[model samples]
Target: MSTTPVEEFEVIIVGAGIAGCAAAKAFGTDGRKVLLLERDLSEPDRIVGELLQPGGINSLKSLGLEDCVEGIDGIPCYGYGVIRKGETVEIPYPIDPETEEQAVGKSFHHGRFIQNLRKAATHTENVTVRELTVNSLLREDDSDKVVGVSAQSKTNEYFRFYAPLTIVCDGLFSKFRKEFTTKTPDVRSNFVGFIIKDLELPLPNRGHVVLAQPSPILMYQISAHDTRVLVDVPGKLPSVSTGDLKAYLEETVGPELPESIRVKFIEALQTERLRSMPNGFLPPSANQSVGMILVGDAMNMRHPLTGGGMTVAFNDIVLLREFLSPENVPSFTDYETIAQQMNSFHWKRKNYCTAINVLAMALYRLFAANHDADLEVLQRGCFSYFQKGGDCVDGPVGLLSGLIQRPIVLIYHFFAVAFHAMYIEAKINGWSGAHLSFIMFFTVLYTACVTILPYLWSEAKY
Candidate 1:
């Protein structure tokens, strides 16, 4: 067999989504050659990553990708409106008096966001974004250190590209991450996404979460006349072709939404074209290999209930840029040096990563609780807690928006909510025969075990 000469770049990044685009832009800005490969170069129109938290917006600004959200008809989201039963409470994102930064998020079409990232990445002189499907990983002998990738072009011609570092930004259903690590995604629930055009919401510039039967549903504006709705189904949903899914939505998810949004829900059902994605959770872990590292959903994932995925991915890119800046380590291919740098990167990222990742899953489990009495109270307690309008609201809102990085702070506020639930239960049932008290203790204990313990485990290990 005759061998072809290898084409070398400083870095080869697979999957040009948010993570890959950000990485390419950062490295390209630093004057490093970057090859960004994607199976489809046209814009994406998926259900996920349509909203950007305030923290994520700031991170994009820092990375010079702020223009990605502009001119896309994106709506500014001030905070979240929690609707339970028939009542609604709005919890605005925390405003810092010191910095005076706006407590706002942004919502737009997921495809537009991807297009923006691609534009920003290609704007840089050193990044070459190409449409290519990565066929397999190229390694050096049996060492398992990925040197590059063998990809097939659109024309079905095979080519080999070599680089010192290969970034697997292939996202949630990554095909390459498992070749190095053996962790299987812990699938929790499924999210079905749909869009309704020409709909108006009462809460003009805020995300609304409907706590209803079966599971929680999220509604927010993605454009002036369109609203995006996501229904969280407890498990794998039955296929729409079954002729029963629309009835299920009308029965369980439709009644929970407000009248204005409910009309749109029915309109969306006419199309019968809801896009579904599994909610997967994977703890952030360090890749011990020398030449390859994972980023974005390819590296770690959390429940999308809180919409913190983009914030975490943008922040990850920020930290990576800082640690591997041109002045710090000009050469990205130094195996030993890059390995040591990655170890430090893992430690420094624990703060925001642990907080956001754990918060998403915990909030989903609490909000999606169907028939558990304790969880029901906890859900009601959560809505009421946010209604108090002070530090009670600021604390958890800050954590949810990715502004607060301390996991201990999350612990304190979470337990406070649990105790508040106990208080509400006691007020309704009256603590007699120690029966109600026992349930309170057990409920709070269960909340702590699920929320706090997993957070500690991820933080301590990574």
Candidate 2:
């Protein structure tokens, strides 16, 4: 009987997206043979993953993949410009205290950025990328330990690949997440996207967030000539095939945009095909299964409102490489030590992940107020707090950018905004009636607690 031999490697990584490619490269650079698998190797055209925060840039550079963002017509983002009812506020990234240099982020076509990452992974020392569709995890009969994977090539040829450790980074709609955890993603809303051409933005080189009716709208230059606009549509969406989506954009969203962007938005609405993605929230869980672990969107995801997805993913890979380095564990065969390291990796990553996760969900709720009284008040307060400048703007923007990882910093500034909102309310209405003023104070404070506490609690869980 003739039998084909199954290929074996030190590590098998499923899904060659941002996290998978980075993991393969990092492990390969450390002298580990890695097999990176993806169903499609062609450039991925996506609405999200187009923007990378400054913290992600730092992590990417640390991984020695800094050149991936180059030669892609990627735009340099300095900060953000937020508009509410035609009023605008510019919030730039905080200056580095030690280096005396401004932090910079990049925005580009999602597919192009991803292709660059795939190229970097392919050129790495011991990494091999193949277009194979992973069918299922290979597990030992007597135990839950995942040994490798079974996959099919384009020609429908079946092959078995084996490794001591396997990483699942199949991304947002992962087929393998249930094998590791019971948690599922909570879909809060959806983002309808449009590509506007030759649009002159109010703030050049800065991401723009417009507080439009119903929800918030995001606009930023992905390339020299093209602008990406993502309109946040809460709950159920209008039917696209029936022209209801077009009517909603034209009748509701179009007029709310700033005058400069409104004209081009209309033009793009007519010419460009509409695209939408669900905004989901999934808290990160510790790796419990032996011989395998989940990473990237498969393991955790947050609302894309703040553009922190890539930042969290790259930073996670940086920590992962350190925890699983040769000097740390030496080999993946030692399942006990690998399990302990994975537990430590979970808690240690909270420093960066917690802030990004909590902030994204919390801010999205506030920004997409949808006529809710408390959130609307908080939204105005957030904008007004930015208008004050200094620590107010610097602190929040820093947390949002992933530069500042401390959850305490985020807590302090969040409450500060709440109190500031109360102050604004008092100023406008006056303290003429003591009873009414007292009642209003606690109401806003209560709203603040309810808005953020649940998300914080979600992060605290395993």
Candidate 3:
């Protein structure tokens, strides 16, 4: 590892995740002196964020990384689907095939995406890839204005690298952000997965979220024709150090997956455990503190559902590029604040994801529920809400997307539901409980039948 500060490093980006790399690349492309740091020099391994949303493609195209992005063999995702109560509604991606439809299904391997982005960042002039483990921030004064970083290689002397502005892209649990700013990660992550890979499994080209049974399993095609299953199993979260991950892989995917995929997945889990970086996806630029700006998981951590994480990082970079574009030399302090307004899009989607995630989990639990009575309650809830387009006030998805700026709109969704639920519950009579329960239960079955029966009759309009 090289020591000594190069005259003036404009931006020091810690962590080489999508957000960090993109921001560095942007600064570099503008010909600014930048340093990109990574904890492990080795390539990133197994992780989620495999399904790149259509919106991700749109973002990448703007960054000029879209064409080669597929060079990583990312499988393009169609759209979202839900399998609830043994019924599945697979939404065929609504892209017009005449244009970029062919490229639309490219699903990104998170590790692969990181490698590709790192390649682009390092190759760009003015960007230096610092392969070392970051220990702490380089503060100029006691106020915590991040002037640079303190880092070291495996067995090398420690070095201090300085920069006027430092961007911490250090995944989630960002020590940098906590040290400098007041932005706390308020997002609570609930789902964890047993990710296993195999070559070209015999599955649909489109993605499927199987909530039909308990412990929701989300399967999507990945970088290779291989697939990754995000199986949501609940109980005491298994220990990571136990090497329990390998045995867990066998029990979860071996029996359910096809033979070839099963074999491949086994080999991957055993050999591909990421001993390096933390197992989480990247995020957009979040907090802006004086000389430090928090990007990726260090700031607004994304939910894995929509697959927009990496692309959002790219979008953040574009913003950083524009801000640092020599034509406009805003103070590094102002740059931090501007990064937030620039990434309003990501936090917007966070709002949407928060609710849909709840919906997905609740639906998964209902699908897996063996108790018929409790299930009836869930069934009624789902059947009524979806059919009515049950708006949770303004709805979380809208808020997360930044479409609805005010968070208070999410509260309205609750108030509306509260009133409606009260009216329904007040009307509950003796066996009417049984009757209403029956109606709720049957309606789901009926909706399924209607969707199926109409297509059978050639009169179904989805």
- Enumerate clash totals for all models, in the order shown: 0, 0, 22
- Top-TM-score structure, candidate number: 2
- Candidate 3 matches the true fold with a TM-score of 0.68
Error of 1 at 293 (Å): 0.8
Better of 1 and 2 by lDDT: 2
Q: Write the per-residue lDDT of candidate 3 for residues 309-402, one digit (tens) a residue.
A: 5554555566556655676665454654555554563454444333333333333344444345445444444433433542531243343222
TM-score of each: 0.96, 0.98, 0.68
Candidate 1 wrong stretches, greater than 4 Å: 1-5, 99-101, 432-437
lDDT of each prediction vs. the true structure? 0.85, 0.92, 0.55
Best by lDDT: 2
Cα RMSD for candidates in order: 1.9, 1.4, 9.3
Candidate 1 colliding pairs? none
lDDT for 394 (candidate 2)? 92
Cα lDDT tens digits for candidate 2, 251-331 = 999999988778889889999999999999999999999989899999999999999999999999999999999999899
Model 2 local distance difference test score: 0.92
Candidate 2 minimal-lDDT segment of 10 residues = 428-437
